[model samples]
Target: MPNPAHATGTDLLVLHALRCVGFAGLARVSEAVGLPEPDVESELIDLAVAGLVTRVPGDFGGWGLTEAGRAADAERIRDELDTAGVRTAVTRAYEDFLVLNPELLDLCTAWQMRSVDGVIAPNDHTDPGYDSRVLERFADFHRRADAVCAELSAALLRFQRYRDRLADALARARSGALDYVVDDMGSYHTVWFQLHEDLLATLGIPRH
Candidate 1:
């Protein structure tokens, strides 16, 4: 009894990732899916060929899902959820995730930038004390986030990966790899974004 709603192929996952992440570079998509850059690029190409997604070339461009892709994903993912009959449970979990969303974003903002002279400034990582305080808050936040992830995984097993990824990112950040907090490819923000996408996809909700 595998979860049929979970993405079965790399191409679908790539397409759906773009659908939720909006537009993103190959590196971002690769990191989000835990796939190699080359593999993600290959899958993106196939999805593009099928007209389910498109790649935009430029400094501010990457890949995105086409209208058709969005429609197809909605229909397919909705059918999967309905078939699994976990809508009410997943919806309740989504509500709980929403409650934690703002706090998570606040933590990410604090990690990336901090208050300085009554103005927000980028944390230069020069102050060990400030960094330690942020890390402590992050640890506390993760404890709460773990509960949300647990609820989500209970509703849909595919979501368990997010809990693992977020914890790994926080651990790396705590160990002095500061980029793991928000700006890096596998940062907590990146993992959280994927979790957000997964919830919307699982519930067949639109980003807007």
Candidate 2:
């Protein structure tokens, strides 16, 4: 299927993705926005030229927004929320997300480690029944999470990308790549963190 993101401006996509992800390389930024690296890198260069973002060099180096970029994004995000008049909608969805957040963390922990004889050790996946139970719970959680995504997407088009990414994470997890749940680049937890960041940024709320 053709991507609906084409209608949205790539510049804003790259800029806002930087706002959400923070200090990511070209590849990471591309994954966040579900855009091709060439397209995303082109926009990043344009943003750099405008003094909105800067690149760092090191083993941990990546792209990050400048002070000016953060300020600009704050203003733009506020305007976008007010213009769409969805502050209440988005805020309510955020509340729902918070409730799901802890559950997801617990589910991921269960997937990664198991308790045996009062000892918490890494799950060796030798127990198929245990693993199957965790996957079932994950599937059920994804259903509830998708509902929240739908509400947010109706409020802001950019939010559609999160829904897409989250679905991909869950899909890969179901296909026997368990890392997609919490360990991989596009892991369910990774997308959830970015989505949470996007919500806070859009609402002008500070992280607590």
Model-by-model lDDT, in order?
A: 0.80, 0.88
lDDT of 2 by residue, 155-193 (tens): 787888999999999899889998898888789988998
Candidate 1 residue lDDT tens string, 1-208: 7454443456666776776667899987876667899999998888888888888898998988889988877777677667667788789888988998999898888877889889988888889998899889989989988998887676555566678889999999999898898888688998888778878776767779
Clashing residue pairs in candidate 1, if any?
none
Q: List runs of model 1 lying over 4 Å from the truth.
A: 1-9, 57-61, 112-124, 206-208
**Candidate 1: global Cα-lDDT?**
0.80
In model 2, how large is the Cα lDDT of residue 97? 88
Q: What local lDDT score does residue 102 receive in model 2, on the 0 to 100 scale?
A: 92
Error of 1 at 68 (Å): 1.0
Error of 2 at 21 (Å): 1.4
